[model samples]
Target: MSKTLHHGLLLLRVLSEQPQGLTVSELADAISVHRTVAHRLVRTLEAHELCRRDHQRRIVLGTGLVSLAEPVQQDLRTLARPILDELAESTRATAHLLVRDGAARMRALMVVEPRGALVHVSFRPGQTHSIEQGSGGVAVLAHGPHREGERPEVSEARAKGYAVTTGEVIPAVTGISAAVPARDRTATASIGISVFEYTDLGQLGTTVAAAARSLGRLLD
Candidate 1:
């Protein structure tokens, strides 16, 4: 990639991790670029409405990204809706579709609450967490080729066909997830459920894995 383009992308990524925004000097240090170069890149991003300066004079992601992201998110949500609804209803829990944001993090792309459940876990879509932190992320990691020093839970998930975690993303809650196989696509994602109490792990895991496979076939 062109050097300028590379730096620009890097700057955006750094800004993403810090939602409150960052000063140009902080952005330069974050991306390992000079202050002037960072400022220029930020200006270019501003021109495209990709990033903007806050009232605090800190650079932040622009609303333009919402326009760019919505269509793609909507397409994924549309495709996964029935599957997620079925999974949520069947499991009597809150089901979520999570996608890898990059190498190190996963983002909740969609969330569905069980229709008939009187009490179910609830969380907003668009939450992000480390790839090693929660069942959703670990399941995605399990689906990918093994890497040195990866969390042991990833390997365990690979062997078991799903991942399970407790109080990782939310205290006192249990999460189980299975990766949606990538097949021929670049997308990497997982389907999962969250419950307030621990229940049948094997049954839940199998159910989640089946849902993930079904979704994978659709993606294929």
Candidate 2:
């Protein structure tokens, strides 16, 4: 890849971690580029409306990315809809599709609640949290090679083909997830369900893992 393009992408990645925005000097330091080069890159991004200067002169991701991302998100939702709906109905819980953001965060891309279910967990899409915080995150982390000092949940997920946790994302709730394999290395995602209670963890795990494998085949 061209050095300029590489640095530009790195700049955007760095800016994504700081929702409040970052100064050009801080951006340069974050991306290991010179201040002048960072300025030129930021200006180029600003021209494309990919990044913009805030009132405080800090650079933040611009609205342009939303327009670019919407269609992709929609397509993913469309492809996963039937599977997620089946998972939700079979598991009798709220099923969700989550995608990795940067290196340490997971965002819910879509959510499906079981039809005719009374008193099921319900959460909106776009919920973002630490990659280590919940079953969905750990399930996604289980993809790729194992890392030293990784969480036990991740290791367990890798071995068992699914992950389970209780009260991690929300109090009194249980989550089960399995990683959805993708052809693109950069595209990390998971399929999961959240419930208030469940007696058969093994069955739930098997169901979710099967759903994940089905989705993974489609994604690949």
Candidate 3:
């Protein structure tokens, strides 16, 4: 790709991470470009409505990006609804679908949740956490290249085709997860259910793995 286009895309990525946006100087430093070069790229993005300056004169992603993302998110929710609902019902736990961010920090993207019981563990949409923390994260990690310093449980999850963790992210809550196979070389994702300690985890892991397989098939 041309250097000019690469710089513009780089600016977009750096801006997306900063919810409060970034000053021109910050953007310049992030991209290893001079302030004038960053400004030129930002102007080109602004012309296409891909980026905008906020009231504080910090650069932010513009509404055009939201238009691009909303339809994709809606389609993903539609595809996962039946599988997530089934997983939640079968296990009597709150079911979730998490995707990897593919960023430097390996954040887990909270994509879907179907509540199981009258009282269920609720993680809000768009929530993110370190990919090393819980069962859902480990499940996705099992499908990818293992990195040094990763939790040892990922290996067991890879061996068993499922992962289970207790009170790791939330005290007294248990998480059972399975990796959803990728489609066309896309990023790997996971499906999980969070339940109380009393639930029969052995059975639930099997159920979750089945649901994950079904969801993975749908992804194709």
Candidate that would win on TM-score: 2
Runs off by more than 4 Å, candidate 1: 1-42, 51-63, 183-187
Measured against the true structure, the TM-scores of the candidates, in listed sequence, are 0.74, 0.86, 0.71
- The list of candidate 3 runs beyond 4 A from truth reads 1-7, 10-36, 46-67, 101-119, 186-188, 198-200
Shift of residue 47 alpha carbon in model 3, Å: 6.4
Looking at model 2, report the run of 10 residues with the lowest lDDT sum.
Answer: 180-189
Tens digits of per-residue lDDT for model 3, 1-220: 7998898889998886776789889999999999999999988889888899999898988877767766876776688888887777776678888766534223334434444366678776667666777787888777777778777899888888899888887788888898888676444678888877544667888888998888788878
Against the reference, the lDDT scores of all candidates come to 0.89, 0.90, 0.78
Candidate 2 Cα deviation (angstroms), residue 189 = 1.4
- Which regions in candidate 2 have their CA more than 4 angstroms from the true location? 1-3, 14-23, 29-33, 53-60, 185-187
> Model 1 — which ten-residue stretch has the worst lDDT?
180-189
Better of 2 and 3 by TM-score: 2
Residue-level lDDT of model 2, residues 98-209, one tens digit each, is 9886567899999999999988998899899988889989998887679899999899988998999889998999999998987775338899999998989999999999
**Model 1 residue 132 CA deviation in Å:** 2.2
